[model samples]
Target chain A: MAVHHKILGVATLLYLLVFFIHVLYFSLKKERVLAVAWMIIYATICVHTLGIVLRWIESYRMGVGHVPLANFYESLIFFAWSVTFILVVMRKKISYPVITMCASLASLFLMGYASISPSVEKNIQPLIPALQSNWLHVHVVTCFIAYAAFVISFICGSLYFVEWKGVIPPKAVLEDINYRSVIVGFYMLSAGILTGAVWAHYAWGSYWSWDPKETWSLITWIIYALFLHARMVRGWREKRIALISIIGFISVVFTYFGVNFILSGLHSYAT
Target chain B: MTLCTLRRLLSFVKEKKTIRLPDEDRLSRMDFHSYVPGKGLGETVGILTKHYRLAVNGEQGAVLERGKLSRYGVFIIHTSIIVILAGSFTGLLFGYRGFVTLKVGETKDRLTLRGKTAAEIPLGFALTCKDFRVNFYPTGEPKDYVSTVEIIENGKVVLGKEIRVNDPLSYKGIRFYQSNYGSAPVFFFNVGGEKIILTEREVFRKNDLLMMVARFEGKVHDFGPGVLVAYLDNGEPKAAWFLKSVDRLREQKLQGVKVSLVDIQEQPYTGLEVSRDPGVFIVWAGFALMLLGLYVNFFLQHRRIYLLRVSEGLLVAGMASRNREDFKKEFEKLTEEINGRTS
Candidate 1:
């Protein structure tokens, strides 16, 4: 087994454990114990980061020598890392145990899928000619960060619709979070799309080919565009905004996965 | 598609309503806070107006610079999107993409479109394929595909280029991309001590010996570029095969004729994808606009603090477009200064 996989597997288990512990502590009226849970989640994120770095080093040792972000397994691990990093950084401001649990669950799910799925190859391999560009870093990092922001916004919106149900923060705070996180997501998605377009033009002859992935990305953007525009509507309020956030996140998931697995396009190799 | 995007923009416009603070009653609702040293309502408004870069109209006021910057951000962002959409529209109106296949030394005046209902579009000038070559990696993978081409206008050379993937040749606003490559077989035969070389699909006949190459393969039992050729032996058709490699040429003699490949004369055909997009610049400019607008819109928050004369000390209230917590700190500072001043 790879070193990163072993570490990340342990990290995934601990993430779930921390998530459960946070929920249990919150339920039992022991709010301070959730601090311990928070620390453990932070430490888990550190371990995850180290595991990714070690995998990068391992790839270098194997002469592949590229960032651990080129394939399904690698990108999923990155997805997990991004979620954990963002959630941990947001721990202070948002400070909701439910949010942390959801984030940890998301990371754990991704790591678990990456490890267990037969379709995902965990081995480090040389990048093909098409991926050998500086834009790989720009495109993937911006994209994953945007994805993580959407995940955060989705969690906030989901919790809001349920009225937080003994969650730490007030409903207004969650609504604020839902709005701010989506703005961050919108900006990052724009940056990601622009960078991806630049990269596409660099590798392929065309910038926007309406490939399934690109088309899905555009659809996701339009959904979010509607979400942003809905904020400007005179009578539309928080609940409607939260609903749009939920819908926009669903579009995000479909754009990221459905376009890869179900639809045939130029980005099939990315899957 | 254009109509769809245009409708989105139209709805965006319909969604926004102009906000303004124009009177004392509106000022009351704004939760005006902070007290400045002044004579009365008129003097207090003067001090407040002096401190803030405001556009005051009939007691309703807005901060000038921040409001302008925020509005500029909104303008730039929306305009950039519209410009991008318009650029795509112009591209669809004027741009056409098609591919041209050329054999070595073959001059083609038009490119073939690839689709269900494809058509040949003329370039108005001839393009000649001078050379085609490929560089290989150590693992025998193709590192680069290069095609040397020359443009011929009115039987005169205008431009010569060696194009590669991502590095296309542009002439008269049309781009020629090196998209693909291949080779055809060329056969050299020595029949009765007479030497002659013939390209694929070209018939060679001398005194009842009519010969033509059927096809060329890179490997026929690892023979390396085996040329399949057919000959009319006294008008009775017969077929023979020979390798392009010189070492393997003597190994297979086709019925008293020493046939060898002149390296199979690998007439590599360069697949040049030609396109002309006139609105590409508008699209690029739109991207530039988006970068600037996004930075302003996301990073810069418009913070406002309205001051209204009240029965007690001036009631302080504040609002920011984003980061209300950070704005709270600044709002406190403003109120502290106003509270300390002599009113």
Candidate 2:
């Protein structure tokens, strides 16, 4: 069962087009077209789910006997899917079409990179000795899930910043939602780091070796720590904190992908 | 005069015994105690001085008073330091790590110790590799490597299991992990004048001293390096010695000892990482505490909802923290529900 990467690729591209349409409709103030765009986004989400499941099956056939998270490309696809999943669920309670648009754009970028980039090979690889444990499933899935949640919060935070600076119309309702998302994201990120650390201790015999991945992750944690402190203690309002949250997410990106490609460390397989 | 001569003879005998030749007496006599004289004395003085000082100065003046230090301030600093120190120290002291490499159908007794200057097996029992295998992905990227290992104690195989990277073989409080792969050179020996080429098929026990007894023609020769002693019962082979060099084999004859070097074969095998960490549970506990602290700190916002009765059966409500806008909306909805019921 070969992974239908081409099918997934096409479906992702179609979703990207739909996301752009949503943006165009919102900018044009066309309510009917915006509703249509939302429906298309939902359909695209189902397709994305199918693509992920298909890739997982293909991995089994390829005899990796592991999840499709052995490398950066698979992780990027997972991240994009997770973000879209959260955004769709969030859209039910919050009426923030613009934030959704940003998330979709991020997801599209991940898919586009996976599909187009030569360095990112979209094939099922066998699990290395370090990744042959059951913890791989639990740890990698949880970490990426948390990462996806952060990405969503990052999008919302970016939107809040734009509205606060009057780049876009003020949406105070979305600002509170954005803060809530960040709080949730921060909690998940903490969980992700803790899980990864525990797993590392078991696999490598050392809990923290100050590897590039671990260091950057701690840096990411500290950034969110500063955001939390500013919000809870300093009584700083939403706009500045939201901007900081976005900055934190960028660090998360560097920690996850940049550290793997640009820097050499124990987590070379992650690249 | 006879008694004086006898005393002189005894003194002369004592001096002769003391001034023995190096080859005749192989041992050296020196004052070993001079190496570390002041160390023991310093420790003794340190303990005695502290004890006497404590006795002289009393607890009242020597110990810090509770009133002098703020409780909250002390708690914050001390607790954080204790947590960090406990985590680091526990991780360092009780952590044992090493690596082992073995080819298919081969067994290894010692694992390469990591982060240590000397070779030491941290585990109580010995581990022997039984088999090693590697599988590749369809994309041609090398995938999994596994090593089958047996836990041995007193020549008895207690447990047999295959250990991979994430999936380790745990026995007797130790784990073996399949980590690396490489090829090494193996040498052959021709003992007892019988031609035997030691190839990749031969397994040499690490640090094992084998006695190679050989007979060549009529002369007998005995040669050895360290514990590996070789005795030729009959050898008149004109005693030629050869040293295996990097580029070319150097031949020399030293004291009529003949040694011939043969082939060097590369043996490919897999490497396994072994570890036994008693501090892992403590590190895991720390992780649990950290996660719990984060969850409580972030997710469970300190929300305080207050309701006050004022002005003829009217209720005023307020929240102290978190999602105030949502709280306000909920409070309004609750008021509306109450009003509807009352009316």
Candidate 3:
């Protein structure tokens, strides 16, 4: 087995452990277990970061030197990494245990699917000429960061609709997180779309091809824009905004996965 | 689609009417920014004012430029959307995308437009394909495709360039991109002391005999480049491989006829996508503006702090257009500093 795979497998196991510990913390309300879970999360993130870096180095060793942001497996790994990394960074700000639990669970889902799915290709592949541009770095990074933010927002928004049993943050805090994450996500998604357009212009000689991926990204952007306008300008609160947030995240998932698998376009290499 | 979005944004901004400052009571005195002596004191202060400056009515302190220019961020974003739409509109009206295929040592002066209207258009100057090359990785994946081309204007070579996937050759606002390539192999053969030339999938015919090139293979059993030839022997179809190596070609007999493979020339054709969009720079400019606008809109806010001279000491009140929670914390910190300095 690959060194990176082994390290990432350890990280994945630790993530599962973190989820169980979070569930325990919710029921028992023990600070010690929560602290242990946070420490484990920190350690898992470090190991996860190492695994990603090692995969990049292994690609270079294979003589096909390129960043790990080139295929489905790498993308899934990076997506999970971005979610956990962001959650850790924002852990102090969003101190609610449920938020952490949900965010970690989301990352775990991505990591699990990436590792166990037969459809996902784990081998490092050579970069195609179209993907050989430097814009790919900015495009994929910004897009994934935006997706991670939306994931956080989706968790908060879904929590807003649920009746919590114990130790959950107030509805106001949940709504605030939903709003703030959408703002961060909106900016990053805009940057991602613009960078993608620039790269496409260089490679295909057309900035806007109305390809399925491009069209779906635009649709996702419009949905988020609607969410922002309704929240900020229209002074929308609680249920409506939360629903928009959930729907916006659905659009995001469709853009990222559905477009790649169900439809064909310039971004077919991602599949 | 862009136009419709622009319309919606314009109406949204217009419907909001203008920027509003929060009304707070318990502050008696006002400053030079359009203060009215009524229930709504300081209502017009900083209202519809594009410039921001410190105004002291009874006391003077410090003046800070708290990103007042950021208020224009919305304007900048709206105009950027318009500029982007206009740029794309210009491209739609004037720009054209076409494709031209040129074999090595071939020149063409026309291109066929690629779209619903598939029409031929003149290139104004002839483009000649001098050479074509492709490189592959050890895994047999294509690394790059390059096409060497020269521009011929009035029978004179003006410019020569090598075009690749991301690197295009441009002249007179028109660009040529290396889009694709294909093998166009030429083979020379001698049959019964007569020389004949053939290419892949070409048929050579003589009296009562016919031969056709079936396919060209880069390798056959680790031997070098070879060709598969199909011929008719008394109306019976038979196929055989012809190797480039002289020893391997010498052993091959074509249905009782002594045919020898003389030479093989592998000439590939380069597929070039030609395009000219005059509004590309405008579109880039719009992108820059959009990024700047978004940064300002997300990071900066319009804030106001009013210090009124009362009978006791001073009354301080603040207002912010966005992120009220953060602005409130900042307002508290600033007020604390003022109290510390004054007392």
Candidate number achieving the greatest lDDT relative to the actual structure: 3
lDDT of 1 at A83: 86
Residue B227 error for model 1, in Å?
9.7
The residue-by-residue lDDT of candidate 1 on B50-73, one tens digit each, is 445554333423332243355356
Model 2 Cα shift for residue A194 (angstroms): 2.2
For each candidate in turn, the interface RMSD (Å) is: 2.7, 2.5, 0.9
The 10-residue segment of model 2 chain A with minimum total lDDT is A161-170
Question: Can you give the TM-score per candidate against the true fold?
Answer: 0.76, 0.71, 0.80
| Cα lDDT for residue B42, candidate 1 | 45
* Residue range A1-271, candidate 3, lDDT tens digits: 8999999999889889889999999888998988998898899899999999999999899998999999889999999998988888778667688888888898899999999999999888898877888898999999999999999999988998899668668998999888878878988898999999988887898889999989999999999988977876799999999999999999999999999899998889998
Q: What docking class should model 2 receive?
A: acceptable
Per-residue lDDT of candidate 3, residues B35-141 (tens digit):
21221213222321233355332222222235665666766776788888889988889999999988888899999999999999999999999999887889999
DockQ of each: 0.23, 0.31, 0.49
For all candidates in order, the CA lDDT equals: 0.75, 0.60, 0.81
Tell how far residue B111 is off in model 1, in angstroms: 3.7
CAPRI category for model 1: incorrect
Candidate 2 local Cα displacement, residue A80, angstroms: 1.6
